[model samples]
Target: MRGGPAFEVLFNINTYLKKKGLRDKFELTFFAPMEKPGQKMGDKALLMMDKMFKSMDIHKQVGSKIVAFESDGIVFENGRKILSDLTMFISAGTGHTILSSSDLPLSEAGFVVTNEYNEVEGFEGIYAIGDSASLMGAKWRAKQGHVAEVMAKNVAYGIAMHIQNIDSKRSYMGQLNILCMMDTGNGAAFVYRSEKGGKMIPLPIIGHWMKKAWGVYCKYSKLGKIPRIPGM
Candidate 1:
């Protein structure tokens, strides 16, 4: 998912299917290009996740190149074949297909070129924020709303200073962080990371309600029915 890790997305889908009494009817396996995907979430999170997946009977195929997707399943470069009834794919990061035809400079992933302040090079008064901008950070880095929100605020400040003839600018570096509220159907986990490292705190029933409340707030705030809570 755009907001969550591929493992979490696929696992949740499996959870949903299980709720319909279909757990024994399918073989669910999670695949990713990264060997240890979700490392950004923290080592503790990954350790916990592995045990959780095993308990749920989910298979994992990661850090392996997919040779091909045959009619029955997947073929790996190492001659490993996993029979899968269906396959779902999501890139780590990608851009619109239309961007490939545009004149704007693009990264290897097809995201737009931009400076730390989200300003497009060779084009004054132009900016690329959110998923549009080529991200800069650790291999564990991800493009989440926190990063996008910081870019948005910084771009606004940078443009305002430009108009005032002030030689000032703000960089999104150091401000962006990894944050996620993961729901496991029953409860949830609060995941966060920064220069100080990362943490994943498991929350019980209350966590589920908290996430639901946030969902409602997100929906209404986007629709102008309510104001966004600060630093959300």
Candidate 2:
């Protein structure tokens, strides 16, 4: 659950299946260590993850991929040997390192240091957001679409405030949340988290349609064929 990309992809796939009303035929096979798997989404999302997994009959294969010698590919703990098929390592963290090494203030974790307003400390007219920037508060803070949207809006407002000399300043520090919609095979659970608390709202039957409607809305809105609803 600690920034596991595979888990996130599986979650999205589950949502897609549920929205399409094709959950019955599919069996989700998770190859992980523990029974109660950890999801990167916050407590509420985590609860929904647990609920979804609990509803399923899962088979656990507890084995780790142990890399043996550098010259040759490694073997698994299950005694299965896999030869290399064009070994390529995609650098996920190195991109952050490249940004941090620039002439900019960086956090200890090697991410660009930015204020609550998404402004880099010493660099004027420069802002940072998304995975490239370190979220300053809440240990459970996640890199999510809504958070990025908020930061983008804040950046726009911050620029306007600087230019128009407005009193209102945007800050994302206190707005850290874990609002997410998790879809199971047949339904979805609405998850929300804040500094105050967290909650998981389970939805069934019609919930699938709601998600489909959301996807349609997203697509049409992005194409400017439809208007985006407020807070959507």
Candidate 3:
């Protein structure tokens, strides 16, 4: 329960209701097995999140493991049952099932083991990147698009250097950080967490377009119709 998608879902549902002017007519609740779902974002962000929930009139059911999902409600390990007519559930990330049968080394969570350069150790010339590779670093680190980009860029550079007999390389290690632009229907929020600390910047109408602009840039850059902004 890293808390990213859950918050997104909460905001999305809340926004949709507000747009229809029915926000006050419905009840919303957030449930999780962890005491703090988005703990990785640091204490400040977590506090802000709690405040957001309160402002939106959303209830919280946290800190107990879910044991069952009944027809009319969900049950928690602590004997609490939440009644609901509609429910949206999101599970935590896990390695692919195919990796379970492979001989490659895997972490306890089942992700493929890789070095900072994304190379598979003991398997020369082989590499595993993106969500396929087990992240090497602090436990708080969660996979993000920027981190995947760094890994892919590094692997490409590493392979080219191998072919040219160059001894140069790049690493995703130095690039690890949390970057997310969460859309809240009418606006968005810019969240960033680096080695220095974590920060959640509120962005309204301008922030919404900022994320949309990036989406446009990303699509065109991938299609080779426009040059990508360096270090984007």
Candidate 4:
């Protein structure tokens, strides 16, 4: 549906399916080019995905197009297959289809092109952020929640700075990192990834409680009853 790691989206789908009691009728699978995919989530989460898939009767396969139909659950380039009743597509790259509707300049993938500070070159006062803007950093740079939030905050700050007659603006480069708490039924794994690489730390039942507490904190803080922790 949107850019970011694929696991998060799959997790949401799985949760929804379980709630609907159709989780058994449908066989959930993860298809990618790599045989040992999900390195983005770190080794533990990757291993956990393997375990989860295996336990749930989910299949894993490598493919090029990763196609699916009503009769066949999914099909790959090598004649390999996994039958499914339904399928949904999610891309972790420039959401080009939507950009084709606009008149803005586009990359090969059709995302809007912008300067280092997120300004459109010839269009003053107009800016693009998040999934629509072309990234100025590494190609592996992903569109994540924090990046979107920071971009929004930076854009706001840029406006304030402009009103104060300032010259410089904020840059999104060097902010490439992934931080997330992965919840399992009874525990969680705290994952962090940066230029240095990645790490995943497992926690027991307390981790689940921490996540629940975090949900409450998030709700209360968003409603202005509590303060939000920095970098959360």
Candidate 5:
């Protein structure tokens, strides 16, 4: 796990392993090409992660890119090799190759370029949302499901306003925030980060159930079997 929301998921796994007394049985190592991973969450969250890593005896490899993966290990660009029985690597996001052949303006990463309102710069009445559209905001900004939903709503509103000849438009920028429920097998944590700061609230047992409930709600609501709660 490098950084962003995935870091919390790794932390949740760590918590589960430790609780089950299986942490020492398997080696856990987090690798990232960046020197300071998780810095996007701010200084306080970084400090907390450092403390957790030290307490859990988790190994971290940073500032080294992986050149190749062998049957039994991984080779780093610096000629260092880390041998492991198993490896789980998370890759950074890249736009679909189809975008490269399209007329849409794209970033170096191939993400379609868009304005604050998710409107394509040169494509009239065409908007790109979700991971397909490049996000513009703080350096820490990331593509997320909630953000995508907001963009969809904004695009719908934009279309209605266009038909009505209204000047008002909605923006997804003001709603940007990191809100996630990080769950371990036995417990969970409420993680929230915004312009103000970041906070992680440990919820011993009920938090796990809360996440499960949210998953059920999402599935049913999407199928149109259950009405979606406003702003859920």
Candidate 6:
């Protein structure tokens, strides 16, 4: 696991497996290159993860760079190998190479540089949202679907205001936050993080259903088949 929300989902799944007496049947191990994975969620979240790892009997290998993946398992740069029957790896996302050849200003990672309202520099009315734009705030900032939605809405509002000659404009900067419902097979956790702090709330059975409903709502809302709630 590469850490963040994806790792949290796996952690919750491990807990569910243990409660169902199926943990012994499967070997689950989490590995990351960073020594302190999930630390970006704040100190409280980091402590909670540490506690969960101990109480759930989950194995972890950190601070080790991965060199390659063999048929059996992973190979580390330190010449250490861990054999496993199955391996699940989640790699980080990168910008498209096509952005490099475009006229837009790009970050070193090749993401389009944009203002707070997602307006691409030197491109006046043009805007770049979603993973295509480079975030411009905290170092721990991540490209998430919710943040992309925020940017999209902001750009839309900005465009409308411009056409109407309204002084009002929206910016995605103040809206930056990590909000996720990490689901397990049986339950889910509400994880939230902002500049002030971070909090993780355990939602047992009902949480799973809530996440499922959210998925349904998102799908229908995006297709305009159902009405979307404000700030959803």
The model with the greatest TM-score is: 3
RMSD from true fold, candidate 5: 2.3
Residue pairs with clashing backbones, model 1: none
Per-residue lDDT of candidate 6, residues 1-232 (tens digit): 3366567566766877778989889877777777888876777877877776776677888788999999999988888888888777777666798888788898887899999989887887989999999888875566789999899888889999999999877889998888877776576768788888888887878888999999999999989999999868
**Candidate 1, TM-score vs. the true structure?**
0.88
**What are the per-residue Cα lDDT tens digits for candidate 2 across 1-232?**
3323444455556667767888575655444433443443456656666556556542233346443424544455667544543222312353355685589887776778898988997787999987778778875567677788889889988888889987777898777887766554356666676777667787876665677788899999989999989778
Residue-level lDDT tens digits of model 1 in 1-232: 2436555566677778888998798888877655887787779878877876898798888888878888888888777888877777765568777777887889998999898989988987989999888998776678887689899999999999999999999999888688787877766778888867788887866877888998899989989999888766
Model 6 poorest 10 in a row by lDDT: 1-10
In what order do the candidates fall by TM-score, top score first?
3, 6, 5, 1, 4, 2
Per-residue alpha-carbon lDDT of candidate 3 for residues 40-80, written as tens digits (9 for 90 to 100) = 78778888888888888899999999999888889999999
Candidate 5, residues 22-102, lDDT tens digits: the string is 988987777777788877666776776777678667888878888898999888888888888877777877889888889
Provide TM-scores for the models.
0.88, 0.69, 0.95, 0.75, 0.88, 0.89
Off by over 4 Å in 3: none
C-alpha local distance difference test of each model? 0.81, 0.65, 0.86, 0.69, 0.81, 0.81
Which of the two, 3 or 4, has more TM-score?
3
Comparison by TM-score, 2 against 5, better one: 5
Instruction: Give me the runs in candidate 6 sitting further than 4 Å from their true place.
Output: 12-22
lDDT, model 1:
0.81
Q: Which regions of candidate 4 are displaced past 4 Å? A: 1-28, 34-36, 41-58, 85-89, 92-98
For model 4, residues 1-232, the per-residue Cα lDDT tens digits are 2323355456556666777889886667767755556566556656766776675566666536555444646677677776665665565465467678987878787788987678788887888888888766753355677787788778888878998999869977767777776665456667777767676676756876787898899889879898888766
Candidate no. 3 TM-score: 0.95
User: In model 1, which runs have C-alpha deviations exceeding 4 angstroms?
Assistant: 1-5
